[model samples]
Target: MTGAPAMTDSLLAVWHAYRLPILVAVSIFFVTLRVYTQSQSRPKTAASSSVPVSPRGQSPEKSQKLDAPAEKPIAPQNPTTKEIFKPAPKSVKPASGPKRVQGKKKPAKTIGGRRPSNEDNDNGPPVSFIQPIVFFASLTTTTERYANAFFPPQLHDISYIDFDDFFTTVPPSSSPDTRYVYCILIPTYNIDTVLSTFLGHLDETHNDFRIDTAPLANLAGYSVFGFGDKEEWPTEEQGFCSQAKEVDRWMAKLTGRKRVYPLGMGDVKSDAENALKDWTEGLLDIFGDILEYGGLGEGVRGSGDAMESDEEDVEDEDESQSGKKKSSTMVDLEDIKMNGDSAAPLPVDFTTVGKAVTVTETAKEMVPKTSPTYTALTKQGYSIVGSHSGVKICRWTKSALRGRGSCYKYSFYGIKSHLCMEATPSLSCSNKCIFCWRHGTNPVGTTWRWKVDEPELIFNGVKEGHYKKIKMLRGVPGVRAERFAEAMRIRHCALSLVGEPIFYPHINRFLEMLHNERISSFLVCNAQHPDQLEALYRVTQLYVSIDASNRESLRKIDRPLHRDFWERFQRCMDILREKRSYQRTVFRLTLVNGFNVDDEVQGYANLVEKALPGLVEIKGVTFCGTSTSAGAGLTMKNVPFYEEVAAFCVALNAELERRGLHYGIAAEHAHSCCILIASDRFKVNGKWHTRIDYQRFFELLEREKADGTPFIPEDYMMETEEWAYFGKGGFNPDDERWFRKNAKPRPTHLIPAEAQAQVDAHVQAQDS
Candidate 1:
C-alpha cells in the first residue's frame, strides 16, 4: 500500500508541473479548427462580386469595430429541404470584356457559340474578375446607351440583363455563412410599375426560399436607385427632387432602410455635360465607397444641381409675347399669327373697358400648383385633358353619341351634339351662379389670377382628351361605334363647361386656335369681364348668360365677385350689343321659378332691348342635383316647369312688342323647357337667321385684319325656320338641309355629307 501511494504522488507532481503548457496547446488546436470550418463554409462567388460598402472607403472587416452591433442569425433550415434556385443554362455566357464606352458596338456572335466570320475570336483577357449579370427593363436604346456610358464595365462589375429575364434568371443559392448584395436600378418614367414588381417577389410565395434580409434592415446592404429625364416629370417643383424624395420614403417603408439615390438626367443632348456628367461622377464615387467598405455608403441628397432654370428669362419671353405696353383690350394681328400663319387677331375695342386684371408672370404663381381636385374629377367620366383646362362628357353629349338624344343647343340652334366638345380654358370662375349645375367645389377668382396656357397646347390637349373620351366609349353598352368615330374629330367647342372660358388671359388666342382648327367656337361669358368681351374675336355663337334682370336680382343669382359688378354687367352688355356684327350674339336667361320668373319679365325685356341680342333663349333652370356647395344651397323648387317657362317667354315677347323690338318666339324645346326668341333683325325676308356660316366668317376675319374692318351681322347669317325647333315639323332628322346646316366639317377631317346623313339616319332609326 505504501508503494502504490508513492507512485500516485510522483504522477500527480509531474501533472502539476506541465499543466500550463498542456492547456495552451489544447486551446490553440480548437481555435485553428474553428477558423478552418468557417473558411470552408464561405460562399464561392467571384472575387469582384458586389458587396455592401460604408460611407468612408474602408473594408467591412476594418470598419466592423465602428459599426453597430451585428444582427442576430436566422434560425437554421432543414438540410432535407429542396433548393429552389436552379443553375443558369450553359448556353448563356456571362458578359466579360474591358469596360465598354457608350455608343461602341460589340462584334456580333454567331449562333450556338460559333464566332461570326466578321469577328476575330482573339477574345482578349477578361477585364474584370467577376462577369456581371445586369438586368434592364423598359429602357429605350438611347437610354440604354446613356446608362452604359454612366456605368462603364472597367469601373463596374455589372451585367445588363433584360428586365423580363430577371426573376427567371435564378440567383445563386444562399449559404449559412454568406449573403448577396442585390442592386436594383429603376426608370423614373415607370416608378410605380418597377417598385410594385420588385415588392411582388417578396410575397408569401418566396417564403420557402430561405433568403434572410434581416442584415439589410439596418445597413443599406441591397442597393436600389432610380434615374430619368427631368423634363418628363409632371411639374418643376415636383419633378426630379420630388420623385427622389418619394423613392426614399417608399424604400424606408418597404425595406426598413432609408438608402435611395435618384439620378436626374436630361431630356435632350444639351443636358449631358450638366446633369449626366455630375451623375456619372457621383456613381464612380459610390463604386469606390462600396469597394472600400462592405456596405452601401451614405445616401446622396443632392447632385450639386438639378434641372435649374432662369425664371427671369421665361418672364421676359412672356412679356415680349404678351406686350405689356399695349392696351389690355388691344389685339395685335402680328402677335396673333405668331403661333400659326393662318390665324388673324380679333378686333380690339377700348371704349367700354372695365377694371380688369391681367395675368402676369407673378400671378402665374397663384395658379393651382397641383390638380388633385381635377385628378378626382377624371374618375367621374371626365377626359384626361388639358395642361390647365378640363373637359367632361356631358349627358347630352353621351346621349347623342349613343343616338339616344341631343342637347338643347342642338334643338335651339342646329348644333350636332356628337360633333361638339364641351370644355373650359379656365377652371376658375368669377361668379358662382346659384342655378349653375357645375361642381360648386371648382376654383374661383375675381380677376385673371392664374397662368394662361398657350393656345396651341390647350387646343392639342383638349382634342386629345376628346379622343380619349370617345375611345373609352367605344365599348360602352349604348354608344354606337360609328357615332363615336364622328365624335373623335370635334366640330364645335362649347365654352360653357364649368368655369368661364373667357377667364383665361389668352381667350382670344384660344379662339383663334379653334378657328384655325376649323372648329367653330360657342363662347359663353357671365358678363363679369367686359374687357375680355371687347378683346374677343368672332365666334359661331356668343351667349351672354343674363342670369338676372336688374342689379338686385343679378347680385342675388349671379353672385358676382367684383365689387363693381353692376358696372361690369352693363359694360359687358354694351360690348355685346356692339359685337353683334360678324358674330351670333344671344342673351341666355335661365328662368328660375321662385327667383327671376316673377314680374321681372319687363325688366328682362328692357335689358334685352339694350343688348339687342340676335336671339334670346329663355330656358327653365335644370335641377342637376346639389352635390356642389352652391348647389347644396339650392333646391328643386327653383326649377321652373315647361308651362311656367312658356308663359315667361310670352310675357317677354309682349314686353319686346311694347318697346317696338322685332323679337318673337321662333322655336321651343319642350324637353328642356326652353324657348328661343328670334329678333326681327334676324328675320330678313321672312326667314329665321340662326345658323352660322363658319367658313365665310373666317374668310372675313382674314380679309379685315389690315384696316380693322368689321363684318356686318348679316355676312355669315344662315336661314332657319320655325319647324327646326323641337316638336316642330322642321325638326325632322331625315331633312338633309337641317343636317347640312348643323353638321359642319371639322378642320381635322373632310366630314362628307354622307357621314352626317348616316348619323341622322341612325338617330331616326333608333327613335322609330
Candidate 2:
C-alpha cells in the first residue's frame, strides 16, 4: 500500500503543477469578463457633482451643449512651458437697457481744513527753525543823550522788544493774512540833523511798516542801515560805529549777504527835494523788485520805498549845509517836539523823584509809580507793594545788612568794589532747600514778568535804599572813595541770592544783558538743576553748595525737584569735573557744628577726588536767613574759633595727602571760612596756574550770567588764610606773647625729627 500511495503522490504532484497554471488562466479570464460586464452595465459617475440649472432661463439642450466642452478631459498645464493655443474667457454682454443707480457719493475727509493725503504731509505749513538773534547795546550815561534823541517814544517804541525777540522777528511772516511788516531800525551817526530828518521820514511813512527804533534794542524782520558823516565822529561815537559794524558782521554771518547799501542825503549832491526823489526811487526800485519776486510784501515796500528814495535825492542838500548846518530840516526837528497840548507835564505820581527808603512805610511813600517794584507787583495782581523790589527784599533788613557788613573786595581783574548789594532782584528758586536765605514771601515764579530795570536805577536805588545803614559802618577802617564807588556799583548778584535763578526761563537772556553791561555775577546753586548748570557756557565761579554727608543727607537738606536728586547731584559733580578744564568751580560745604562736621573729612575728600574743583571752601554755617532754624537746632555758632577750625582743616589736609590729594588752607575770614585748594597746579612762587585757560574761564563765566552769579573779577586773587586774617591780626611781630596767644604751634609729630632738624638749621642759616 505504501508503494502504490508513493506512485499516486508522484502522479498527483506532477498533475497539480500543470493544473495550477490552467486554473490561474481560467480564473483571470472569468475576472476579466466580470469586470468588463460590470463596466458596460454600470452608469458613468462624474468626478464632482454637477451644479443645478434653471430650465426656464435656458433650454436644457442649449445648456447641455454649452457644458459639453467642460465634460471633456482637460490636459494638465505646465506653467514652465508656453501654451501653443489658449482659449480666451467668454465676455459677458450687458442687456441693452439703462443702468440702475446704487448709492450716494461721500464727501472727502480733510486735515486741518485741507484734503488728507500723503501730499498734505509734504505741503504742510513750515515750522520756524530760526534761532533768535541777540543784540547787546552797551549804553552808558554819555551815550544816553544820543539814544534819547535817536529813539523817542512817540516816534518809535523799540524798548518793547528784547534782543532775543529782535533776532526771532528778523524773518518776515509766512502767512498771507498778516499785513504788518516788523522791522528793526538802528541809526548810527554823529549828526543830529541826519537823525532828525530820518525820524521825520519814519513818522511820515508810518503806514508802510511798523518801525521799532529803540536805542540798544533790536528790531525784527527789518533792514538796518547806518547813517554817519564819516568826517566828524565823537570818541564815544567809535563804540556806535563798532556796534554797527558788529551788527553788519552778524547779518553777514547769518544771511551770507555782505554788501550793504546806505540811504541818506549826506551821500548825494543835489537839493533836499531832488535827493529825496533819488533816494525814494532807488528804494522803490530795489524793494519793488524784491516784492515782485515775493521776497518782501507791500507792507514793507509801500511808502518806505518813496520815503527812502526821497532821502537820496536830498543828499546834495545835506552836503551843501554840512559845514554851516547846526541841525537837519527845521521841520523834521519840530516833528519830534512835544505839542503844547501833548506836552502836559508828567504826573507827579509818574515821576521818579526821591531815593528809596529803608522802612516799608517810608519806602511806600517815596516809591514812584514808575518804580520797578510798583510796576511788577501791580502786574502780578499783588496790591501789597512793600519796600523790597520783590517780597524777598524784606530779607535785606537793617540788621541782616549790618550783620553781613561790607568789605573791600577786589575782582580778579583788579577792579576794586565794596561787597554792598545783598539780594538778587529776581527771586524764584528751583530748589526748595532747608537752608535757603530767601524769605517765604519771595516770588516763586520761574520767569521775569516785568521788564528789567536799568543798572543805574538798581545802583541808585540800592544806595538810597541802604544809605544810613551803610554810613553807620564808616568806623571800619580802610574805606576809600574808590571803595564807596565800587559799593554803589555793587549789583553783585549771589547766585544763591534768594531762589534758583537758573530756573528762570529768561535766565540766559538776563545774564546776557548783564554781561553786555559789564555786570559781574557770582552764581551759586545746590546742584539741583543740572540742565541749567550744563547749559552754562560761563560764570565768575560755579559754586556747588554741598550740605550733606551722603545722598540721604542731600535729600534731607536740599528738597530737590527730582526724586533722583542724588543721581542728579552726582551728575552735577561730573559736570564740575569737566569745569576743571575751563572754569574755577568752587565746591562749598557749609559745615554745621554737629550735623555734617563729623563726616566732613571723608565726604569732602571724596568730592575732591571726583570734581577736583579749583577751590573747596569748607565753612561754618552762618546763622543768617533761613539757616537760623537749622543753626538753632544743631546749636551751630556763627563764629567758630579759627584755631579749632584750622586744626580740623589741617587734619583733613593731611588725610587728603594720604589719598594722593594736595590741599592748602586758602582763607579763614569772619566765620571760620577755610578755602582748600587742590595744590596740583599751584606753586610756591606766587604764580597761580590752572589746567584751564583764562579765555575759556571768561567764556564759562559769560555762560553763567543768567544764574545771577557774581563774577570774581579777572584781577581778584584768592587770598591764603594767613594773608587774609591771621597775618593782619592783632598778634604783633614785636609781641611774642600776642603771637603765642593767637598762633597754634605746629604738631611735632607732623614733622619728622630729621626734617625738623633741617628746617631749624635752615632758619639758623637765614638768621645769620
RMSD of each: 28.2, 37.7
For model 1, how does the per-residue alpha-carbon lDDT over 697-749 read when each residue is reduced to its tens digit?
77777777657877776787677745564235233263232133576653433
Model 1 vs truth, CA RMSD: 28.2
Q: For candidate 2, what is the lDDT? A: 0.38
Q: Could you tell me the TM-score of candidate 1?
A: 0.49
Best by TM-score: 1
Candidate 1 at 240: error in angstroms?
A: 24
lDDT of 2 by residue, 372-460 (tens): 33444444332322222322222222222333222212211211224434434344443444445432223332222233444444434
Worst 10 residues of 2 by lDDT: 77-86
Determine the backbone clash count of candidate 2.
46
Provide the overall lDDT of each model, using Cα atoms, as 2-decimal numbers: 0.53, 0.38
Residue 628 lDDT, candidate 2, scale 0-100: 25
Deviating ranges (above 4 Å) for candidate 1: 1-372, 384-387, 627-632, 705-710, 725-768
